[model samples]
Target chain A: MRLERRASVPPILYVAAPLAAVMVALAISGALIALAGASVPEAYRRMAIGAFGSRLAITETLTRATPLILTGLAAAVAFRARLWNIGAEGQFYIAALATAALGGAASAGGLLPGPLLIPFLMICGAAVGAMLLLAPLALRLRFGVDEVVVTLLLNFVVLLFVSMMIDGPLRDRMAFGWPQSVRVSPEAALPKLWQGTRLHVGLLVAVAMSVVVWIIQSRTAFGLEAKAAGFNPRAAAFAGVPIPKVLVGVACLSGGLAGLAGAIEVMGVKGYVTTDLSPGFGYAGIVVAMLAALNPIGVVAASLFVAATFVGVDGMSRALKVPSFIADVTVALSLLCVLVALTLVTYRIRR
Target chain B: MSETLDILASASLWAAVLRIATPLLFGVLGALLCERSGVLNLGIEGIMTFGAMIAWLTVFKTGDLWFGLAAALACGALFGLLHGGLTVVLGLSQHVAGLGVTLLGSSLSYYLYRLAIPVSGSPPTITPFQPLKIPLLSDIPLLGEALFSQTAPTYLAILLTLAVAYALAKTPLGLAIRLVGENPHAAEAQGLDPIRLRIGVVAFGSALMALGGAFLTTAAFNSFFPTMVQGRGWVCIALVVFASWMPLRALGGALLFAFFDAFQLRLQHVTGKAAPYQLFLMIPYLMSIAALVVFARRAKVPQALMQPYRRGER
Candidate 1:
C-alpha cells in the first residue's frame, strides 16, 4: 500500500531480488517435478553433480560455454549501442563456414608454421563474420530501420543459406553425401589446453574478450557514446552525438563477435562446419544478455549460469530419465521468473 | 517458345500453393483480429501447437473429425482468454506474458504427448483429415482445380479471409476493436470497455488461429509433430506488420509466403538444379527482413499493440 516509500531503501535489495527470483523459480519447478511424479531434491542433486562435479563434465561444460561467452558478448556489444542483433546464430554458422573454408586452405599451405597460422585463421574468421553483419547494420542505422525485426528474420535466411552451402558446395566429396565439410589439418587446429579434454584456446579467447569488453564499455569514448545513444537517442542527438554511426558500429561489433564465436568453434574444436553447427546460440544469447541486464561482466556470470543449466540437463536426463529438453523449459522459466523478480529493483514487492 | 510452353505445364505447382497457403491463411486472419484490438497475438505458434494437440487427442479418442476440429478451436479460445486476462486485466507486459503462454503451452504439450506414448521407435502419428473435393470444380482446369480441390479447412481458410475482410471493413464491432486499438481512452469516452473488447477480440482471434493448427495436423500432415509450427506464429506476426494491419493485405502476404514454401518444395525435383532450393527456402525470411527494412518505421502499427493497458489514473 505504501507505494510512496521510496525514501527508505537498501542497495542490497537489487542483489536480493535476483536471488529471490531464482529461489521462487526453483520452487515452482519443484512443484512441476512433483506433478511429474519425481523428487525435487533428487533432481537438483542429479543436475548439480552432472554440471560441476566431474572433470569431464566441467570440460564439456566449458566447451559449451565457449560459444556462449562470445555470443553473449556479441549480444552485449550491440545492446550496448542499443542495436538489437538477434541473428547471431546465423552469423555463427556463416562464420563457421568461413573459418572452415580458411582452415581447408590453410592446411594446404604447409609453409606457415603453427605460431603464424593460428592467428591468421582466427583473423580471417572474425573479418568474414564482421563483413556479413555490416550490411544489415548499415541499412538499419542509415535507413532508420528497426534492427530487431531485420536481424531476427535474417536468422532464418542465414540458416537456409548455410544449408544450401552444405547441401551443395561444401558437402565433403569423401564423406558419402554427408552434410559436413572436410575436417581441417591437425596443424591448423586450435591446440588443446587440457591434456585429456576437448577444451581448448577458445575458452581463453572468451575470457580475454570479456575483459576487453569490460574495458571498452567502461573506459572508451565509443562506449560512452553507446551508453548515451542507448539510454536516450533523442537526448544524445541533442548533445550532437552521431546516433546512426554508433548504432551501425555497435551492430558490426555484435555481428563480428557472433562471427568470431562461430570461427572459434570451427578452428578450436570441430575443425569443420556442419549444417547444425549452431543450435540456437543466438536465442540463448538473448537470454544471457537479458539475464546480465546489459552488463558485460554480468554477461560472463550469466553465460556460466546458462551453461550450468544446459550441462545439468544432460545429467538429470540420464539419471532421472527426464528428457533433456526440460533444460530449455527450465531456462525459460528461470528467465521469466528472474525478470519478474527484477521488478523489485524498481518497485516495491508488497506481500 | 515450345520449351517455355512445356515449362508452364504443371498442376502440382498450383496444388502446392493451396497446400502451403492453408495454415498461413488461418494464422494470419487470426492475427488480423488481435492486431485490430491492439493485442499483438505473438503466441500464435504456441496456440497452434495447443490446438493441434487437443484436436489430435480428440480425434485419437473419438474418431470424429468435425468434433476434433471444434476442440482445437476451443483450446485456442481458452488460451486467448488467458492471454487476454494476463495482459488486459493484470496489465503484465504482453511480450513476456505471451512468450510465457507459448512456452507453457508448447512445453506442456510436448511433455503430455511424450507421456501418452513414451519411448516409442517413432513418435505416434495421426491420420490426417480427407480433402473435401468441390462438387463440380474438382474436375475444372488449372484455376478451378487448384482453388477448390483441397481439405475442408483449405476452403475454410479462403472463406475466413472473406469473413475477416467483411467483418473488419463493414461491422460496428470491428470499429470498436479498432477504436480500442488506436486510442483506448477515447474508446472509453464513447462508453466502451477497452478491456472487455480486448478480451473478446483476443479470444476470437485465438479460435481462428487454433483452427490453423488443426488444419496442420488434420488436413496437411495427418499427425502431430513437436515444434511443428517452427516459428510460423512469428511469421504471422511479421505478416501483421507487413500488411500494416489490413485483412486482405495479410492474405496477400500469407499467399506470397505459401508460394515461396511451395516453390521450394518443388525446386528439389528439377533433375539436378540444387542451388535455387536454398534461395527458395530463404524467401519467406528474406521477405520478412525486406518488409521490416522497408516499412518498419513507416508501417502504421496499431497504437497500443504492445503497451499494457492500465484501467485508470493518468
Candidate 2:
C-alpha cells in the first residue's frame, strides 16, 4: 500500500528547484573560492562578467553549451525510455568520425559549397551514431540484455577506434607528426554567426533540436508511450504497449541526436578533428540531463549554468593564481550535492 | 622454430604476464566475490586506484610498505562501506550511486595528487614493490619462477582468490551471502539481514580491490597518475559481465584480458606494430559488449540486483 505521503509538489516548484539547488551549490562553491584564497565577491562578479563580458566569451559559452545541450537531450531521451545509453561519449566519437569522412570527401571533390555540405555531413554523422547505437539497442530489446553494461563498454571500444583513426589513417601528412585528421574544407565549414567568434551554425542547430525535442517529448504519442514504458513495464504491457520496440526506437533517436552534436562540432568549431574534441561531453550530458531532471526546457537552462561554472573557473584561473581544475572539483562537488538534493524532491528522507 | 623457442624460452615474459595479471586478478576476484553476494561493485577500478594511491603515499611518508598496504586496504573498505551504506542500507540506486563513488574516489585521488605533487611531485614514479622470492621455488626453471617470484601483494592476491572461492562456496556465511544475492527478501525472512550480508560481502570485496590498486602503485607503476586507470574500472565491469557472474569464469576472462594487454605491450616494441596497440586494446572491451549481447539472454542477475529493499516494506 502507498504511504500517506504529502501531495505531489507543483510543477512550477519542481522546475524552480534545480535553479534553487544550483544557487545553494554556488554558495558552497563561493566558500571554496574563499578557501582558494580568492575574494569570493570578486570571484562571483568575475564569473558572471566573464561569461557575458564580451561577445567572444558569450559565444564560447554558447558553443561549449551546444554539445552539452545535444548530449543532454540524448540522455534525456534514452533515460526517458528507461534505457541508460551510457556510451554516448563513444557514440559522439563515432558520429564525429562519420561526419569527418563526409567533410573530407565532399570538400575534396569540391562538389558542394560549405553551406550545403555541412548539413549533409551532419546527417551522415548522425546516421553513423544511430547505427552503432542500434547494436546495443537491438540486443537489449530482442535479447533482454542489460543495456547499461553493454552501452558503457561500447564507449571505450568506439573511443579507441576513433583514436586509432586519428593516430593512423587520419593522421595529417603535412602536420609533421601529430595525431589529428585532415582539416575540413572551407566549403564544409559552418557559417560563423558572429565576427571574431568561434560560434557558428552548430549552436543554432542545437537550439532547434532542443525545441523539436521538447515538442516530441511532451506533445507526441511516441513520447507518452516511452514514459509509460519507463514508469512501469508491467502496466505498459498490460496496456499493450510494445515495451521493447519503443525502447529501441527511443535509443536510436537519442543516439542520432548525440551523433548530430558530434557532427556539428566537426563542421563548425574545430575544422579538423583532434583527440580532445568532445571532452567527456557524453558523460557530462548525463550530469546535465540529471541536473535538469530530464526536462527539455530545464536541460536548456541547466547546461548554461553548468557551462557558466566552467567559464567562470577559467576566468578565475586567469584572474587569480588558482588552477582551473579547482573549478572542475567545485563543479563535481556541486553535482553530487545537487543529486542528493534532487532525490529529496521526489522521495522524502525518512531518516 | 627457434623463434618460438626464444619466445617460450625467455622466462621473463611469462613472469611479466603473471606480474601484470596480478592486479587484474585481484580486481576481478574482488568483483567476483561482491557479485556472488549479489552486489555488482562497479567502483572496483576507482577503489583500486585510490587504494594504490593511498598505499603509495603512505609508504612514501612512513617508509614502511606494509603500513601503506594497510592504509590502502582501509581506503578500499571505506568505499565498500559507502557502497554498502547506499545500496544496502539507504536503498539508493546501486548503479548510479556506485558510479558516483567511482567519480568521487577518482576525483579525490587526482586532487590529492595535485595537492601533494604541485606539478613537480615526481610524476608518480614511486619505488614500486620489490619482488619477493619464495625460497625453494625460486630455483625452478620457468613455471615456478613465473608464478612464485613476485611481490608480496601478488602472492596475497592468489591466496585471497583461492580463499574467497572456498569461503563463498563452502562457508555457512557464504551461503547467507549467496542467499542475500539470489533472494534478499527470502534471506531476510529466514532471519538473515540482507543488508548486513551485502555490506559484509562488499566490504570484503572492496578490501581486495584496494589490494589490487596497491599492487599497481607500490609494485606496478609505483605512483599514481591522474589517468592511471584509463578506463580499467570499465574493463573490470566488462570482465565480470563477460564471465557471466561466475567467479571461475571471471578469472578466465580477466586472465585472457590481461594476456591481451600484455601481448599488446610486447607488440608495441616490435617493428610495424605500434598502430595495432590501439586495435588490440579494443579487444577486451569489444569482447565484453559482445558477451553481454550474446550471453545476457541466458544469464540472470540476482533477484534483487539494483533494487533497494526497504525494511518491513509491502
Candidate 3:
C-alpha cells in the first residue's frame, strides 16, 4: 500500500532508468523543437551531426566537453561526500583569475621558461580554488553556516572581481578596446591534441584526471570515509570517521577540479580571460554529476553528452534559425526527469 | 562636499531605496513563509522570473495590469505546486528539486519570453505601474513621500508583511504551521496533516514571490529583459536568513539591503571612473554575506527545515 525501498534493485534498472529518462526528456524537448519551427527528427539529426558527425565536429564537442568533465568531476567528488559545493562557479572564476594573473605577470617578467609556465599557472589556479573553498568549509564546520548560500553568493563576488580585473587591472592594452585580459604567452597555452582543430591537450588532462578520480573514489581509504560520511555523518562519526576532515578534503578537491577546468579553458581555447568565459559550466556540472550518479568514470561520459547537447543546439540554431536556448530548456527538463527516474531506481510502489 | 550632502539628503534617493525594497520585501516574505514551514524553496529566483514574464506577457496582451498581476499569482501557484509535489509528495531531495525548479523556471521563462517577444533592435516596452501619491501623507516630508508615494503592490507588500507577522504570532493556523515546521511528528500525533500544511504555505508563499517578480516588470522597470531578476531572488534568500524568518525583521532587512543597493547606484554617478563601480556593486552582496556570517549562527531555523516528512518514519 506504500512505497518502500528495494532491498536489492535489479541491475537492469540502473541502465534502463537513465535511458528512459533521457527518452522522456527527448520526447518532450522534441515537441519543443517542433514548436521552434524545425522538424524534430531533422533537428535531432543536425544536432547529432554537429556533435559527432565529423572529426572537426567531434573535436569541437570534446573541446566543449573538456571543462564539463572537470567541473562534473568537481561536483561528483564533493556531492559524493555529501558536500553541496555550489560554489564551483565561484571557484572557477577565482582560479581563472589567478591563472590569468600569474600568466600575465610571468609574461611581463619574462623570467619563467615558457615550457614551465603552463604547469606553474595550472598549479597556482588549482591552489587558489582549494584555498577559496577552505574558508567556506571552515565556516560550515565550525559555525554551521550554510555552504549553499555562502558558495552561491561567492559566485557574484568572484564574477564581479573578474569583471573588474578584465576591465581595469588586466585590460589587454594591445587589443583594440575589448573587455578582455591579455592573452597568455604561447608557451603557456595548452598544446593542441590534433592539428587543425580547437581540441587541445586539456582533453587528455581531463581524461587523466578522470582516471585519477576513479581510482581515488574506488580504491582509496579516504573515499571510503567520504562515502560513509556522506551517507550518515553521525553514524560515520560514531564509526570513527573524521567527518570534518573528510568534508574539508572533499571540498578542496572539488574546488580544485573546477579551478582546473577554468585554467584549461583559458589555456586551451581563449588564451585570455573574458567576462563570458564560462557559460554556466560550473552549474552544468551539477547536472552532469547527478546524471552520472556521482560515479567518477561516469562523469567523463556524462560530460561528453552534455557538451554535445550544448554544441549541437548551437549548430541547430545556426542551421534551423531556432534559438539555441532550446538546449537550456532540454538540459533543465532532463535534470528533473533524471531525478524522477533516479527516485524510481531505489524505491518502488508496494501493494 | 555640500553637493554630496545634497544628493544623500534627497527625498528621491529615499524613494529609490523604498522602490528597490518592494520586490525584495515581497520575495523575502515569500521565502520566510516557506522556510518557516520547513521547506527551503530555492526555486524563489525561478518562480519570480516565471511570474515576471507571465505578468509582463499578460499585461502586454490585455493591457490590464490587474489581470497581469493575477496571472503572475497563478503562475507562482503552479510552480509552488510543482515544487511541493517534488519535495513533499514525491519525497525527493529538496535541494535538487529546488535547483531543478530554478533551472526549469528560468529557461522556460526565457524561452517563452523569446517566443512572446521576437528579437528586435530594442526590446519591447509596456506601460508600467505609475506611482500613486497619497494626498496628505506624501506631502509631509522626505520620509512621508518615500513611504506613501508608491505603487499599489508596494503598499500591499508592507501590509502583507505586517499581516504575516500578526498571523504567525496570533492565529491557530499559524500555530499549526509553526508546530509542523518545528516538529511534524507532534503535529501528526495531534491529527494535523503536515503535507497539506506544507503545500499550502509553499503555494501561498510562491504567489507572493510571483508578485515580487511581477513588480519588477510592472512597477519597477515596465520592460522585461533576459536575466532581469538579476539575483534579487537570491538576495531574498539571504535576507530570510538575515531576518531570522521574522516578517517584520524581513522588512527592515529588505530596506537595509535596498539602501545599500540604492546608494551604490548614486555612488556610481559620483565616483564614476574614479572608483570601480563593480567593487561598489559588490558591497551589497558582501554585506549580505557578512550579515549571514554574524546572524545565521544564532538564527532560529525551523527544527524540521529541509527534512521531508514521511508518515510513520520516526
The candidates' DockQ values read: 0.40, 0.46, 0.68
Candidate 1 residues lying further than 4 Å off, grouped into runs, are: A1-9, A142-145, A348-351, B1-11, B39-41, B66-109, B137-139, B191-207, B274-276, B291-298, B309-314
Error of 3 at A346 (Å): 1.0
Candidate 2 ranges with C-alpha deviation above 4 Å: A1-7, A10-13, A20-46, A142-144, B1-9, B121-124
In model 3, the Cα lDDT at residue A66 comes to 94
The 10-residue segment of model 2 chain A with minimum total lDDT is: A1-10
Write down the worst ten-residue block by lDDT for model 3 chain A.
A1-10
Q: Residue A67 deviation, candidate 2, in Å?
A: 0.5
The sequence of per-residue lDDT tens digits that candidate 3 reaches over residues B46-115 is: 9999999999999999999999999999999899998988888678878878888888889888888887
Q: How would the docking of model 2 be graded?
A: acceptable
Count backbone overlaps in model 3. 0
* Docking level of model 1: acceptable
| Candidate whose lDDT is highest | 3
- For every model in order, the fraction of real contacts preserved is 0.36, 0.45, 0.51
i-RMS for every candidate:
3.4, 3.1, 1.2
Across A97-204, the per-residue lDDT of candidate 2 in tens digits comes to 877766777777887876678778888888887777888888877887777777777887887887888777876667766588777787888888997898887888
Q: Which ten residues in a row have the lowest lDDT in candidate 1 chain B?
A: B1-10
